[model samples]
Target: MKKIIFSFVTSVLLLLPNMVKADEGMWFLMFIKRLNERNMQKMGLQLTAEEIYSINNNSLKNAIVQFNGGCTASIVSPDGLVFTNHHCGYGAIAGLSTPEHNYLKDGYWAKTRAEELSPKSLYVRFFVRMDNVTDRMLSVVNPQMTEKEREAALNREMEKIQKENSEGGKYVVSVRPFFQGNEYYYFVYQDFKDVRFVGTPPENVGKFGGDTDNWEWPRHTGDFSVFRVYTDPNGNPAEYSPNNIPLKAKKFLNVSLKGVQEKDFAMILGYPGRTNRWVPSYWVDQQVKYAYPAWVEASKTAMDAMKRHMDKDKGVRLKYASRYASTANYWKNRQGMINALTAHKTADQKRDAEKKFAKWASKDANKAEFGNVLSDMENYFAKTNQESANHNYLSIFFRASRITPLVVGFTKQLEQYLSSSSDQEKEQIKNRLEKNLYAYYDESYYPAEVDLFADNLKLYAEKSSSIPSELSQVKQQYNGDFKRYANDVFSRSIFTSKINFDQFMKQPSAEVLHNDPLAKIATALLTKYYQKTPEEEKLADTYAKAFRKYVKGMRDSKISTTLYPDANSTLRLTYGTVKALPADKRNADVKENYYTTFKTMLDKYKPGDPEFDMPARFVDLYNKKEFGRYLDKDGTMHVNFLTNNDITGGNSGSPVMNGNGELIGLAFDGNIEAMAGDVIFDKKLQRTIVVDIRYMLWVIDVYSGAKHIVDELNIIQ
Candidate 1:
């Protein structure tokens, strides 16, 4: 009973709200009624827990989907019309964009099914069910076993259990640990591969305010996108094929045209990627003081290099647009997190919790289960800090370089070719290299690549624990002039041009690769990495043992508190009210900005601006007051809104639903003031920014001129 209660506190899987407030949790639906139903009902939930998560019948869970592994999406029509965020679908949009048919610059719409563009590698997954496998998993090990022994035993059962219950490879089975391995749950999923892009507003409409407005409230960005899921005629998950038809949605959410108001109930259901509200104070200190600064600096440098190339050419921009946005968003995310965590004194707060736990463990009755946990964790972090810093700092060079990926791939293939005895194996590998591999690097610009190479090499030399010994010699030979060194490496590299790549393909050999300048650099760097980290590995083993004990202690001490595991990209539901920041810190007056209007969007609008520009069609509709059925009584078209729902990265396109299970908005961004939300929940400051469902409908109906798509939705007025 004590263990179960503790599992409820730290795991994101637990529905019980034992934190700041009921609104602070990204809860699992399975335990809703048992822990949260009364409070939820009192707060204005019209649907029962069964109506939200039942497996025997259609429920709210049937409508929500994991969008392409990153964002969330909702089925809005019986024919499987899906709604998600524009940025969530940014990659798919960018892939479909070309200079002649720039769907990114000018919006895209498919009046007919044939016009819907299907990108090569985008898929959505549906959760079939979840099962508590805690007892079955925990039965395999006991306190006497070492972490290695326990893992080996658990692995044996994991394979058998997954194999036994996967429905003959039809369902994707995942068994994830929760509450720091105190509990486990099995989730079954079905992946649909035929999702197609239905419509997207132009850059100005979809990405209004762009970076400036991201993570800000009073936001005006119309950050929504449309999609359609296709499955076999029998309505089964299938690969992309011409024979597939639109999926018959088991359940679909109705779009609410009424919008939101102050104190209105709002809930979100989606896959929230991760959260670490239970991490130790030392870990938070590591990120805030040591690690994140390097990441922010290196990422900003990489983004600058990519943006330089993207700005030079339209085709390059099309290829790198999504990459750049992803880079920029996270770079700023790290910067903001550093600032927010410092302001909140998150580490100090975590230390207080640790102190409480330490006192609890100091009790003689509890000492055996939690002895040395705090000290062990402290030493583990201290020991691993240098290794982590070196790896993260040096890893950016490979991440930022186009040539490194190709070289890595080629080097692997060359090594394999040398060892393989079969003629057919070599031939097969060569064919793939000729056909698929070389074409991927077409978007890379030589000048940017050269510059990035020099910059990263310089950065590594200055920051990494030790530069690769070979590269150290090369640095001396070049008199520490990395620019000239970069030119020498790029100029000699066979991957720099198609002419050289073609030559290398003809006589690919391990000897040639062993002598290659880039390959030598890769080898020396990887060698240094392996040589640098024997101590951290041992400390990590110690940390893992101590972590389990600490969690056990936390559970024992928090017997009265509800505990939940941290998030691990599983489906969750979080509920809260339409809320706002205090208008000013000076008074009791709170500014509950429930929604934004098109008229307000125009206030921040600038003609021909990359971030704020709008298509003339949208401008014309706004000018003429053409909001159709999607406007409020005040005659303003809604664009975006705010809710206090808890969400993180993977919940981007989650449905912001009303009391009656109708879609009101799409969850997109989180407020910057609570950027450290992944580490700690700031109940008062945290807010999920959502694009108003009415605004999405109006854009589909008016701006994009896709009324047919609007007609598909079950619009609730």
Candidate 2:
């Protein structure tokens, strides 16, 4: 371990003086002292690297956490008051909302700790520490080993390492591969599962522009939400309980009421999800030409189907709100990626980079180890492109349909229950399944709404190259009319209704399941979706090996001057100055293109429109110019601002701090022009959208009159 740390730190120190632009890299926190401390100091940082990521002391890293394993969040108060993006907390908020209460629409504020709501499941993971394990991982395999053998060896070693570092399962330990498979790092995290919802703005303010303004700039969404982490009396992780108390956090960020100005130093700390900056051109081609278009079309189809039902009934809307938002957000994102990648010619850029890499690898010194890497990848992708495309289409067809998951999940459990020989075990499984069915009926099952799955499935059949052979008879019976087939199936399937399910459970048999229409479709879909030939699997293994060599060769040959690994949900810090976009008519009213204000947001408001509606109280506040202490120096209430900080999906709700490490804003969205950023970082155009911390405070303290929540924060005026 010492040797690993010493070698890694030495490499970072050697590259310190010649690193890329401040806005470009998603950098590791452990090497900040060697790689970024001096640069950050020169860029206006007031704290040392030790103060930001120290293990011996409670540093800035202690305040940040992986929210619900998918998003990033931060601690803002000693009582463990957590702040994250509104959309990040959407599931929790929606879970607590009902048609009558509609907290998702009207919003909710917990004036006291007792009023805070707990969702069925939610947790936040704090970064405990990380260390290099590449040498130990690689030591288990050799060139003579097949890909399967190598993978098995690595998994065994990884499992051993995880068990060793888990402190007897107290911490969640993950061994993640970086740069494909060239390096590995094990991350230790302590999860606090007793998080409670505190407050959020209504959709009008929180998700102001909805999907229309999701990735676009000049945004007004107050995309922030409040929650609190709770733990046992001894301040240790625990599940939800009435006896739990608010955690006494190790460190929390001080909220800054002072607003940002163009060129001011900005820094962000969070776990960014993923980036594929080193992917080959063929991979880009596959995404743009096949995978993304299918995803976009299928997602839009689901959105349209869900909207039809949601529009007529408020209950349906409340039930499907979170699911719809997720589908719509990605729907727009995938399309944006297509257009952005095409316009930027990102594939061409990758091809040029690969050309250079191939030339470098051709040298006699490197040829034996890396010469065939690019060719192997090309051959693999060329042969599997169509199969890959069909698989992607079917994947979304399953993902976007509510019925498919329940049908598949329940069927799997039923099959397991049938196979059990022990009467005691069978009874327990039956009871659990019965409980789940009741929960689904009460909370999630909406038959009328899910009827749209027929249309979604029809779209899938039309877009995909082929359907499973098992479903070919049904397709032929209806002459490929999926709507008719789906209707016939839904009218008879036992899984479609609780009474039917109860009756079927009394006479459980494999024959009945085989004869069931929905079950047949589910079975066929699963079989075809996962069916890959052995030859194709072998090609995938070959591709993986080649890609790893490609990445390692690029680093060793100095093709990638700054060898920072791509993001894999690790804690990283990115710093840059607050930046402005090119001048545009839409943002002409603003003093600069970097920031947006209430007046501009109101200008785009549409009365009674789901995407652009303005709350009555918000209008009154704006009309009265009731800016209060949250107003910017220019006399307008700033809403969202731009920074050049390198960020991606999981970075949503990350704290965008000033050089002094004071929280100024919460990073929420990215500009649409740089949608291809996941594949390539365009420093010139890519920007991180942030909600001003003052705006969040104004909403909680002034608008909602939650003065006690405001008082918990260490506010810097």
**TM-score for all models, in order of appearance:** 0.94, 0.97
Residues 106-196 of candidate 2: C-alpha lDDT, one tens digit per residue: 8889988999999989999999898888889989989777788999999999999999999999999999998888889999999999999
lDDT of candidate 2? 0.87
lDDT of each: 0.81, 0.87
Q: Best-fitting candidate, measured by lDDT?
A: 2
TM-score winner among the candidates?
2
Q: After best superposition, candidate 2 residue 285: deviation in angstroms? A: 1.0
Relative to the true structure, candidate 1 reaches a TM of 0.94
